[model samples]
Target chain A: MQNGYYIGVDLGGTKICTALVNEEGKVFKEVTVPTEAEKGELKIVENINNTIKEVLGDVKIEEVLAIGVGSPGPLDVKNGLIVETPNLPFKNFNIVKAIKDVYNTEVFLDNDANAATLGEFVFGAGMLTTNMVYVTASTGVGGGAILNGRIFRGSTSNAVEIGHTTVNIHGRRCGCGNRGCVEGISSGTAIAKTANEAVKSNVPTSLKNYDVVTSKEVFIEAAKGDRVAKEILDEALSYLGILFANLANSYDPDMIVLGGGVSNGGDIVFEKIAEEMNRRALKPIREHCKIEKAKLGGRAGVLGAAALAITELEHKNKKDGYIIYN
Target chain B: MQNGYYIGVDLGGTKICTALVNEEGKVFKEVTVPTEAEKGELKIVENINNTIKEVLGDVKIEEVLAIGVGSPGPLDVKNGLIVETPNLPFKNFNIVKAIKDVYNTEVFLDNDANAATLGEFVFGAGMLTTNMVYVTASTGVGGGAILNGRIFRGSTSNAVEIGHTTVNIHGRRCGCGNRGCVEGISSGTAIAKTANEAVKSNVPTSLKNYDVVTSKEVFIEAAKGDRVAKEILDEALSYLGILFANLANSYDPDMIVLGGGVSNGGDIVFEKIAEEMNRRALKPIREHCKIEKAKLGGRAGVLGAAALAITELEHKNKKDGYIIYN
Candidate 1:
């Protein structure tokens, strides 16, 4: 293994989390701070740097292998620039340069999805798999793929947009302006919206007891045997299952790691997905491809950023003809 | 380019086509022979050998760089074994060893879809691109992909099974025992099946004039302004569009090359696909990903075999640390 530490910065809308991690994925120190977006881009950058410095502690700068930043997209990963994102104030911001100017070491940047994918590939559910797909179904559906043991970024660095892929040709329109997208039909937000619609329609359900009903409440109600809640969950989860089956047929991955809020729905989620795979996916693929929940949970973001740094550093070393120990 | 000839064998149930090709993808000699598959496995093997010998002509066996065979799957590509396929009579047959025994050269075996993908990547529509997907929607909807300049064979060598991917979650049952597959809704066979169903239902249309209606007759009738034919094709082509759009969202490829019988349905097919893509695909992907008709046509199979030979040889040489001129 490489004898150096790595710093990972997980930049998000609500908070910034930084960690100092070893090559084997052990975290020695960590820090978290709110992302005060109202204070502007430079302030957010300062907060990120402060978190990095806090985590460094007694570790020398010279011992650090690389720094990695995982943020929301759309980003120009090649140039390490955040093109524009809804939550962040960055507009064509050269984030890689900002980090490198402060750290004086190699820095890598990628979308949060890709970072999480690397996290799974390196230390989570996909550790031993050569080809794995990681899907996160929360407010929205997003995914990343590791094919042949490397992150598969497509032509425009926007590959594996699994959420937007249509599962129903004449289905409801998605926020991406496409109809029948898996995200529109199966995401946590989508589930909540359906529940709210049912409530507005005065449908017979325990969901009406709450002033606000989300996907989590729906899951609870469904467990209590609420008919409408079960129907809504069944419809959403079935679409998710179709999406998984489609992915299996297309990628033939060794495994698919399901992450984010919806995945935490427990046995119902896995059972539905497995049933769909058995029904839709080709026999060989369905039999071989394992569907597992992500192991990292909330720490996925920070660890994924750390993994990004490690893998990028290794790739650079190999390309530069320098032999690496691990 | 490497100074050697390559032999390509396109193995099918009805006939075997062999071609001697150069590094530049030009065929110098070719031969075709009946497979005589009913005569059994040994006879088919003998016929394949005879075709290879005929294509060899005056070229010395020592000068041949490699032989590539493209056949129907379920194949054990790693072990060069034809496990079993609906077409042809091969069960766990070591086709690679059989070819190498006669020619004393490197032999590469891949499924037809992967071979065709390589052919497009090396010599056809995707020559200049690093990431491309090839879709053949004829009797069935099958495809292959080249990502990062190499064929992306999934864990089980069944990657890029686009036909089996679902587009209409509640659509029709497929022959593969899945419901709402693109193969079940949009493939030529599917189109023909739908048209036949309509004919049997006594739908008022020009399709009733045909004793044996196929997708071809439907296309002809649609072009002649028959309302029933137009509606059938419109519905089928719309689903295909959704399939293509979903592919764009998932892959974000530089291009998607459409081939096979359905693609050759002239302007209607392309127009419908384009319309659906515009409506469903993400803006960035729709704008960047070119949807083009396949260029190789009837020669795709033979040249694809040749391409498989060239690419596999290059890959092996690279892995073995041998340098060769391009």
Candidate 2:
């Protein structure tokens, strides 16, 4: 029931970002450190604790109510455990307990994608709408849904795994052991892989000059009128469109916000995906939705994690018979 | 709120099914009538009224709490209006107003599939779990979602349009003007059409002997070891598997309940779909859900509509500052 400041941590494979945020969700200070995941769980925990300490600076311990960590998932949110993240080194990492033991404050943990979606809903592109789906096409395609202004975590709190939904049943093998999942076709890794393969196959393209073609290079080449690059982008965006359209039909959200590394390829990516969505989806499904880029940018992860902490505190307070104040 | 009996009406293209249901979700009396939809909205409304009156018999009006109707949709549930049902004779039909005017009682209307899901959750296969997806593979694939023991109505109460979700980007055209939707490949209509086309295309099969091929006959033939029939069934079931897996990934529901005519093909249908789901879906996604047959059967439509009435009454009473009790 205590109302005060909160700490939000965005834990990634390579780095940890932490911020001290007030009740109104404003960040007073922020800090970051390398995860050095290969050094394992102890090193990662130390990095997280250090980042939080650096972010807090001289702030009094009593001023902070809770800490929220948005880490790589499929997490056991109920148990406050990281089940087995694809990128993170640890299995069954008890992040909440570790943070609470170190900081002596309440800790909340959620999927990084879910945290970012909440951040967008609370402070970014989706602030105007209560219902939204946030899709981040980073190294992987990740999604989170906001329904009636609350995170729509499914039965096991591991729902909204949009990337794993199959778009092409007979297509490429996904890391999750599925064939032609949207993540395998439309994510930044997928785009880069598609480009690299096209080059290796001796396709007549400017992309062949690069030893390792990134998603950025492909989009840049496509914009400059490289036919092969445009084709690659088109294929990826088409599948991304199917994914978005399916989401639109399934959830009927008011808006879809696109974020992550690949989204930086700019309006062409959005335009192409939106076009495919409009063309492929039934009229009613596509009509009410606006496809917009995430406005919170890189800050979404920390802000969202912070927001999750605040949200969890509110839920806890309500459950304990305390009245929540705006 | 006043704890009393309610009425449920399932309005379909072919028939109108009505039932008088008590607060504890028991049906006291039931009646059915042909829709005769081509005779237009007024005639359809008359049929609906007659059916409801017949179902009520000698029951006192004051004892009835409210009426709930489940009709073919994409409906405007908020306005209690049938926005534009493709099968019905009328567009923009105010069904709630019509029923309320004739009976002089409060009325609520929802999509038939949504009502059926609620019915299943409230009284059938889904009663054991709060998070569920109900798929009816009837003439067309239809779906409804139940989350946290309440209907998961999306932004416009048009959420969970599972049928329209694309299973294959390069697959068949759906009636909803989308290509490769699950409804285009897995619905009863799709099975029959595929069978009829196979027969016409000079495929050497037992199905060629029948002038009019039905989805049931195809299943029967498949059971009797007809290769063409088995192939057709396999294709349809594979698409259905994709559809189910997609739902499993998207919602992470505790259970998926299958209802409608095609499901009567029985364990083979469920088995084939489960096999495909297990093979194609990520292990964690497929591991948590049990896909089972709908227990409510023919009673689902009426019961769901009735549940909708009670639920609506509860919400209304709660909103009006009244505490509801059974």
Per-candidate Cα lDDT values, in order, are: 0.90, 0.85
Which model scores highest in TM-score? 1
User: Distance from true position, residue B217, model 2, in Å?
Assistant: 1.1
Among the numbered candidates, top DockQ falls to: 1
TM values, all candidates:
0.97, 0.94
Local lDDT at A185 for model 2: 91
In candidate 1, stretches whose alpha carbon ends up further than 4 angstroms from where it belongs are A320-326, B320-326
lDDT of 2 by residue, B1-326 (tens): 35778999999999989999887678899998899989999999999999888887888767888888999887888777899887798788888888877787778888999999988887788888878999999799988988666687777777888888888767688997778988999999999999998998877899887778999999988998899999998988888988888888888889999999988997779988898788766677678888999988888899999988877787786673111221
Candidate 1 residue pairs in clash (backbone atoms < 3 Å): none
- What is the C-alpha RMSD, rounded to one decimal, of candidate 2? 3.3
Superposition error at B40 for model 2 (Å) = 3.5
Chain B TM-score in each of the candidates = 0.96, 0.93
